[model samples]
Target: MQSNGPLYLLHQGQVVKFGFRVERRHVNPMDNLHGGMMASFCDMLLPLSVYRKDSAVGPRFLPTISLQIDYLAPAPLGCWVEGEAELLRATRSLVFAQGLVRADGVLCARVSGVFKIGPEFTPETAKP
Candidate 1:
């Protein structure tokens, strides 16, 4: 499991949807969803989005080079958080993506990321 989250794959073909429930551990001191957790969720969302589209060939192993998250609102605990991502661009060695995180129908965060899509991620070249 690449993610520590209880994330689930919703629609895996064209548009990728990943969702999870906000638990107590995901909150901050004020009982709002932690920014770090939200950023982590976005990190997972982007790569999964890229891989879902390229599934016919194989799983795409993308490592984040840069990730940016914009916090728009707070997500209370016990809310259902859904992440949807779009592949903005793909080059020979990089992939760019952006998405949104919505909790209980309210937009809570927006995220964009750049990922490296090269040999380092492949099983043959990865170090164990």
Candidate 2:
């Protein structure tokens, strides 16, 4: 379960920074972070971002309903990729957020996603 990353938070509060260390496995044949891994990283990052802001209720799963990514540049292997997400809007049942991933201060990708939220996401309802 920890395989996707040793993803760690740079700050412990609502506005958070997540950093991922680029490894050989995360690269494409061209030696850049793979597109799929970037997408997966965004998928994982957004929810964690949402959770950070909502941690007062304990963590809840924000199941992504839609996700879009714009690859601006290739993140070379051995670089530390970092990104931050903010909750843009939230309704009774859905939440929206956007984020950017960068390497060496260069934008690597931009991502935005919508997630479903409700009682189904409550901590007690979460599957172990």
Candidate 3:
């Protein structure tokens, strides 16, 4: 994830917004944002919609069960890409989320994911 660094997040009610600038490492040979990078960004960002500090589940690890991404347009180098994710539904054991990725307000990708709720997570448990 460090390779994709300098990620920023903003919480707005139930929606989570994320932003990142496209650097050289984030682009493909054609100087456009790489698809894999976009997918990884979505994977990391969408789960925030299911996170709640006051919920019975508390803070838990979310493991992706399925991720679907539709690429709509290209994001050129140096563009600032922004994304917004929201929880569509969540059960005790699963969470569903959808998100959109845009570059300078132009739609770039549409994403949806299903995540399995895992055991309680903390910084200690996150250590390798």
Is 1 or 2 the stronger prediction by TM-score? 2
Clashing pairs in model 2? none
Root-mean-square deviation per candidate:
2.9, 2.4, 2.1
Task: Tell me, by lDDT, which candidate is best.
Answer: 3
Q: Model 2 over residues 2-110: C-alpha lDDT tens digits?
A: 7778887876655688888889999999989999989988998787887787653226667889999999999999999999888888877788989999987899999
Please give the CA lDDT of all the candidate structures.
0.83, 0.83, 0.84
Worst window of 10 by summed lDDT in candidate 1: 52-61
Q: Report the error of model 2 at residue 35, Å.
A: 0.4
Give the number of the best model, judged by TM-score.
3
In Å, residue 124's CA in model 1 sits off its true spot by: 8.9
TM-score per candidate: 0.86, 0.87, 0.89
- Candidate 2 — which residues are off by over 4 angstroms? 55-58, 118-128
- Pairs in steric clash, model 3: none
Question: Over all chains combined, what TM-score does candidate 2 have?
Answer: 0.87
Least lDDT summed over 10 consecutive residues: which range in candidate 3?
A: 49-58
What is the C-alpha RMSD, rounded to one decimal, of candidate 3?
Answer: 2.1
